[model samples]
Target chain A: MNIALFGKLIQLLIKEKMAYRGDFLLSAFAQIVSYGGEYIVIWLFMKRFPLLAGWTWPEIALLYSFGLLTYAIGASFSFVQMRELEGQVRQGTFDNLLIKPINPYFYLISRGFNLAYVAHITISGAVLIWAIGQLNVQWTLLNWAYVLLAVVSGAMIQAGLLTAIGAATFLWVRAGFLFTIFFRLKEFISYPLPLFGTFIQLLLTIGVPLAFVNFYPAAFLLAHDSAPLPGWAMWLAPLVGPLVYGLGYLLWTSGANKYQGAGG
Target chain B: MDSFELHRYVYKLPVNAFREQLRFCMDLLSVGEFAHKPVRQLSLGQRMRVEIAMALLHEPRILFLDEPTIGLDVMAKDQIRQFLRAVNRKKPTASPGRNLPGRSLPRASLPGALPDERRYGVTTYMMFAVKSFTNQLAYRSEVWLRLLGNLLAILIQVEIWRAVIGSSGQEGASLDQMITYSILNPLLLALLSTNVSEAVDSSLKSGSIATELIRPLSYPLYLLAGSLGLSLYKLAFTVAPAFALAGLLFGVLPPASPMNLLAFVAALLIAMLMSFLLGYLVSLLAFWLMSHFALSWMLGGLITIFSGSFLPLWFYSSGWAAVAEALPFQYLGYVPAAVYLGTMTDEAMWRTLAIGLIWAAALLLLVRWLWSRAVRRLIIQGG
Candidate 1:
């Protein structure tokens, strides 16, 4: 909503983050090692076994990267705002937003443009790039543009889900469980969609559409598009991101209205 | 997204401080540069400044703080000292040039009494444990969701293990054993990973570490007892229910035999103590290091791999398994689970248990030494 302000906030966070030069370096190393360990678990297991649902190691890595890339970008901004909503609602402090002259959404998102995710983005981005190379993905201009759009849309899907969850806090203060459930589901999407049973596949595709965040886009990219959803749906990143985020915004508006009407 | 909880706390005040007022406080404290930074990004001095601003934002007549400058450098402590003095002496600023005096006591929350030197008995620590157990009971409404989350975690692991093992059955560990392994990791985690590091870290920050250390009760024992309370609570509520659900939905294999079950129980208790000891060992480093992030983080990685929580030792190459056996981490995660599966040979079980006892004793001695030294430093330097 406010491009300059968002950029400015990001700038300030980076500078502040770098102020702890030694600590940051140590923690970044630890962060990489920690996340790398998670991947190592998968790698170690897969090394001994056959392909999971016919999905190779590199292919699985790509899918996992898509999930991380989307989350890193989306959560780099919206993570704090979304989690903060439940507390604000329960404490009756969200009214500060309604009373403010500035758009609360912009204020909330921009203020938390966390630079902590620099590690996540770099780690995931490297993995995604390496996976793409390993898979020999044809990098046509249109394909490149499509990849970019999918990444962006995947991020929106994450942020939109979080936003809707946050907005629902306006209706019920104890909407925190949704956040936990949403995160657990995010873990599920790191695998190929069809690796799961029909129920889970359906849940990912329709119940929540978490598939669009990684599974489907990844399938489309690798040309192994045997997902539960149709072929064209794999390319729906641009539409889904905004569509979900728009719905979240609508929920926010209505929730805000009810909160104000109740004099809360 | 990392701004301090200052905004939320500020807004939660009975009287909302206008955004303009917040800006004024930020400027006054020279915390202007920190307005958008996450709390984690801030230096000790910077965070202290933000804390001061948070307190001042509500325009409270009296301010109470606990060890605001406890970990600050000389210059930063003096700056905070000067700021508090100035604020205390200044006229009420909510209205300009007011005759009313502002009541501010920055070190007000510091406990006054520190006389008890009597050592606490086991019963006293048990009371502490019971308190810890009841502390978690306040969130009854959230219990079901947490249970569901636990169940979901179990389901994810079960499916992955099934898919991996179903097609290509491994050596001694069959599909049933593998399923049991997947389900047990979460159950053990819920029962044993008591977040001892966080508990100890917070107490250190709150200045309660001084009191706990000075008391005759062994602080580590107290922590162990407290965490034991937490584990029991988890078993009764979260772990037991989730285990039942998982057992019903996706069958978890029973122990290899009656003897294996007995050994498994013994190993589980040992595993609990091992994890708690390791957590305490790392967390106590905060005294010398002031932050335990890197060490605990390193240990977490080691545990994930070496402990067989990520992959059972059976799945690993024999060389890798041998290397894992060389470390104490296997006791924390692998030994108990393996014993339950009856995969561990009788001789191996007895041998591992013996070594595990030695490791536990060694860690207890190490924790006691470090904690005593930490207490000495705290008292001498007034941490």
Candidate 2:
């Protein structure tokens, strides 16, 4: 639970990844290209049509960058943890954490601080800055602070989202399928949600609430009258992440408490 | 029956035609308790039970089991022994015997070695092909999830095309054709592209591949057969379901001509072969590559971009589309989709199919040569 211990874990993970320098460099480049290909597809679509849902290519780029930035920041912490949770739960390996004095959730979260997402961060971070520079938004201190805070909130929302999904492993015992669905569902939010129908809009805002991860914040920042549901979410954007994350934490605790010993 | 049932495929095999045998084997082995569960959820003992049930499905004349009761609990071991005894009472089956790599294990005491002949070549090779299908039986959930995702993907793309084309309509493409393109492209990809790279990577790293190469089998041919079987599995589960669901919901157009339909099917067969070779060629790089992450990432990106899987070549700029056309990757996605979309004339479709086969053959030759070098390297490394 200590902050220093968390920092040490991260440092250890980084050092471990850095040991394979050739692997590290080549994979980083490859990941950039892999993700960068999707961006090119979006750009190509834009080439055929000047605007989509009344947003220019740069504007769409800004929205896309928001999703990537938050995803990279969020997944860097929870990707490995969430991905491996089902196996760990099934095998009763999570019991390994119960033996330790430290909080198991914190311990679980620390080990997931993967270094692979460095490439994701770099691409998304660069794209965010470049897109911001391209736009004509006012350079005010309050706006900058909201953007920064919203980015953190977005990351927490993503992390919380995966964590909540991962917690279901306790109940189902085979929750690996949900993470696959999680990825496919993320594609729904990558585009302007307005392009979708009322059903999709309602689903994103209320059902899973992943729209808060990128769409709502982008709308709030750009001062566009987007996010048809929960109109007040724009003003209370900073609270969104913590609220979802709290629910996720609650799910995690209850699921952990329900756990029986190794035999199950 | 759940999609996990073996009765869906192998319809011609009378043993597999009945679900009764499946349940009987499952119950006998005690795997029925966790029949709905994924492979990852199973313990070593539980997995052994599932494999045992699978082997018992066909009522094998001589099941080549090795250490059947190795990791099982005392109860499970007794159950397996009892079942084996019951089976052996009716027909001969495996007994406690060690199998040597060079010798087959079956007859009276030693082994019933099959005389190596070209006549049995196909029957021997078919085992590798069927292996790919059985391997996918572990994850029934993945199949359904992928189907849902596929339909959603096609829906989104069709919607996107609507937005782009607008009321006035597009330049060279109609809304219907574009919708067909959206559905068919992903369908072709789902039905054809088998990730044989991961198979190669694992075999090489784990040294399991040494057994494949040292044997008379052609490793690349082995991979090709596996991929073909995988595509066939996908065709039944993924492609057929998605095609029915998408066609029903969105109303995908029929072929421009009956000839186009013929060409589309032919193109797909060649594309499947072409993709397996391409994937194998890239995966062989792990022999010298630092990490598979780089190769997988790079190859995935390059294929997605150049194959025009995400976007058809027609959607690309004239210059960009031409670049895609120049590469062999186009046959993986664009050609099949384009053929179905009726982008090519009748004769042009035939030409494309011919070219795809040639490319597949050329890639196979290159793979064969590279494998020779790889085998030589393994020998030097004292494999």
* Candidate 2 displacement at residue B220 in angstroms: 2.2
State which candidate has the highest DockQ.
2
| Per-residue lDDT of model 1, residues A1-264, tens digit only | 578877888788779878887777777677667777677777777777648777888889888888988998888767888798777776667777778777878777877676767777888889888888888778899888888998888898888888888887877677888888998888788777776788988988777878888887778877885667678887676688888878877887677677743233
**Candidate 1 local Cα displacement, residue B53, angstroms:** 32
Off by over 4 Å in 1: A91-98, A260-264, B1-117, B167-172, B208-216, B293-295, B380-383
Query: Which lDDT value does model 1 have at A140?
Result: 94
lDDT of 2 by residue, A1-264 (tens): 389999899899889988987889899999999888878878877887777777778888889889998988888778789778878877778899877888878889887777888898899888889989988898799889989888888888888888898788888877877887777778887788888778878887877777888788787777666858556677566788888888888898788888775364
lDDT of candidate 2 over B76-172, digit per residue (tens): 7777777676666645544433333244444332222212233325644566677678777656668988899888788777777777786566557
lDDT by residue for model 1 (B273-365), tens: 888899999998877776778777778777777888858887777777788889998887778889988897899898899899999999999
TM-score, each model? 0.80, 0.83
Pairs with steric clashes in candidate 1: A112-B1, B2-B38, B119-B216
lDDT of 1 at B154: 74
Local lDDT at A75 for model 1 = 85
- Model 2 earns a TM-score of 0.83
